[model samples]
Target: MNLLRSQLGRPSRRWAAIGIASAAVAGLVVSLSGCSSSTTPKAPENTVAQGQWPSYYPSDYGTIVDGAKKEGGELTIYSNTDQENWAPIFRDFQKKYPFVTKISANNLDSDEVFQRQLSESATGNAPADLLATNAVQAWATYNNEPGRVMEYQSPELAKMPDFAQVMPNVYAISMDPVGLAYNAKLLGGEPTSIADLAALVSADPAKFKNKITTRDVSGSFGFTVSKGFVDGNTDAWASLEKILPSARPETSSGTQIEKITSGEYLAGFFISSAVAFPAQDKAQGIFKFVFPKDGTVVLGRGIGITPKAPHANTAKLFIDFLLSEEGQNAVSEGGLTAYRDSVKPAPGRHTYGEIVDQAGESAVIRVPYKITSDADVKAFTDKWNGMLGK
Candidate 1:
């Protein structure tokens, strides 16, 4: 079957949809401050309160906004967050802080964001105000790299449960659990486990061959999913080995779901709800998604300020907004499962924290395991690549 020719839907245009909505806001900042983003600070020593962030009122938030406005309201971000997912968030932020005139969000997937941070380091140009990404690449790139990420203990930190903070510098903005999606019209039987997926495929390998979809473990979000699978369950890899032969590798959940919608593929494993939720609504009832009982994959997507961000105050404001109840509301509307449990549950899907509650703690495997075992990550990646016919 010619996958390309038979395609009926294209991937979501999020990557190309960066919102250039800050020009006016930027002008306002310039008019107000007569200062450039260069006025923003460089290191922690130059920073204000390190941990006393998002203060209740006049003391903290007011100061932050005033500082941000003076810094030119221009904040650039490097993240995998899609335009459709983040546009509302950024817009809402701009509405709240009209002085923020320049908000540019570049749509880079996790791997690309990680690599770019490195490139910036080499050239000594860390322009991004913030870094938003999954734990896999985020931790790999910033956690160990001593001075790369900034530590802002936003008062939002005090509200979040200790576990929600991925690391000292990184805070979980939202989470997208790996959902099992199958063509609704094509597969009627609800699968409760990965073994069920394998059995279904084993039953009809011909139809399933090259028709199944999963993260490409060689890179992208797949790298984290692969590692999380091994760390979570011993039997997970065995089930994947059963399905990999017929599965087509896709680095993106967006493309995988497009294939699933188009009938080029029938199912997608470990797909992000951020992508799946949008596709489900856009595909007109063609897709059905559920978390598996054996163990569902959960990716905690987080953010942190940069060490030498050009718009440090603006970046902090953005981070504060992201962790705020209002900002998280925008997060849910964007499609991904939200991180904050306090954020009221949406109509159809609840916050991922609640989802985890309903699924039972034992049934969920949070990806980017807290324990970063390099040897284990290496072993799992190697095994996954080998299974994928590398």
Candidate 2:
């Protein structure tokens, strides 16, 4: 089977398309609504036991365990993303695996997470069983020190296309096509493009001063913005930096977005499709998200088992569960998935493609990848911070 690529900037019904292809192979091709990978049928309910499954069972990681037992153990995962958002999925998973005795999940800043992981591993203490974080840092940590992450292929992963599993050890679970977000009430109307909004922000410093928020140069959102500037056309960058003086940078994307929603800041320089739009839908008035005609950046968060994981078996079980149809449904409900091939943006979490369609040709940008390496990222951040005098 040919591996299909994930289309980030455009809204391709890849998920629905793949379903049709599968049905065609089975001699029953047809177009369907809300019919995606999530709706795919499961293996026979009582077909195989957990321990008897073959290794590397599927091309991706789809057939490791035919079925998992309701067994549980303790696990500590060190993650940079919010655990509260992921809590519901974990709780549901607990229903399936009632034996899980203890679970420790903490949300920390990505930079500190990297520092601590490196520091702790230097010593004898292995503080985590699962490592779910921004792709760049995770890749850096795993590559900087080989054998730090174990390779246990889960069957559920095989259901995903090749883009979902970039590395055997790293499972890229969620993709966030990030752009600028604004408070609809304050703006009177949404800007036609990012450049236009930035110009407006720059022209009226008194009106928008300190009302523009962006992530600290050290975080992933900050990286997203910098990469955007680098990848965007001349007019886009010119307008983007015009608002730099009115901006206040925060340590986390959530904080930056919160400030924007509260009117403490009128807009965020870079916003995730998952985080920004979903939060807006719950707000009292209209709020808007913008993906300029320029391409938007797709930041994927990868989840994997740690190298020195004490609860290795349990950790693998958790990864498998996350890649399952049930788990992916929970993810879509939470408004964090950006893969056009699987779960799409829910009602509240506006999509990247939607924003671009609204902008038309004015929002000309490039979708930037290769921002995951340490040297490249450090250089980019340094240049980006210098622009803000940080």
Candidate 3:
């Protein structure tokens, strides 16, 4: 299937003529004689003129299309992921909606995505049109604040799983799994689980000492991933006790992937597939990752439109597009796991369905999107820090 033409079909000659005439009437262009003189009128900014929308999409979705066009086609996003990761998604969105003239996306830490939004909003400045991050606790807090998130139920919701709708307005943009990463050349054997890594470290404490890396559990991203894995597996803490002494904690998945690839760290566990999978493609043959045989923790990167969105209509269009099948494919191409069952498979790309198939449904533990009380966080952090000898 041609990705470009799939969502937006060819415009009929009749509609094309109508579009041109409308533009002429609006003074956007003037035609003389049988010859055309001005730049071609922008494609009609409605569902009928652009192409067929999904059958399941609401019939009134065209209103959103028209509203977005009037908003000057500008969108701002606050997310924890790098811009490079959003390149393919942004490109495809622009192709589908050519009138979207500008998009500003900022890559920030998970907690900072909301922090910045709150700060900006408090100062009477417009905040992001959309917010996306894997910080579960941060999301819970942000959602609790009145008027922070726009309550929108997208037309794409019908096709998504129940879990995809994390909260009233928030939805999962990607279902990313956390796994073990290693330097294939430096590690003697492929470690498939925490137990396997524990055995390796126990056997050769000196060699593996300070060569293992994992996330620092103090940060939101780190804490959520670490806690998710530990809570899901009964023996996780037991295995980490044998392994953590030999491990160093890092603050970000990018750092963990780099260290593993450089052989600075022989192995890293609970590393995000979203960041690791793309790098593994360029690691030659030294870097590899495995979804633990014991269990794999899947975390959803949640997204929602802000209540004070400067371009609210444009934001709505973007949220719907991201949840659509075409958007899911673009997301996978951009190095994030696409969960839609309809998305086709590609090398190095994975879907939530594929992960469940490979890992077994029982072994694929998903972290629920909910608030973590301060007490619970402290208790978990204390235990995790204690194991690390911090």
Query: For each candidate, what TM-score against the reference?
Result: 0.78, 0.68, 0.83
Model 1 TM-score, 2 decimals: 0.78
Which segments of model 3 are wrong by more than 4 Å? 1-51
Candidate with top TM-score is 3
Model 2: residue 137 alpha-carbon error in angstroms: 3.3
Residue 320 lDDT in candidate 2: 68
Candidate 2, overall lDDT?
Answer: 0.55
Candidate 1: tens digits of C-alpha lDDT, residues 341-384: 68766443337766566556787887662544557556766676
**lDDT (10s digit) by residue, model 3, range 1-390:** 011011101112110111112233233221111122133232222122133468788888888888989997778888765554466566667667768767777656567677788898889996579998777778887788677789899888889887778877999998989888899999898887878989999999999989999888777767888888888989888899998988888876778888988889999988877667666666678999888878899988899999879899889888888888878876776667888778866664568877777667787888987777778888987787777733
**Worst ten-residue run, lDDT, model 3?**
1-10
lDDT of 2 by residue, 276-323 (tens): 654554555655666655545556677778787777777877776666
Return whichever of 1 and 2 wins on TM-score: 1
Best by lDDT: 3
lDDT of each: 0.65, 0.55, 0.74
Ten-residue region with minimum lDDT total, candidate 1? 1-10
Candidate 2, run of 10 with poorest lDDT: 1-10
- Judge candidate 1 at residue 312 and give its lDDT: 88
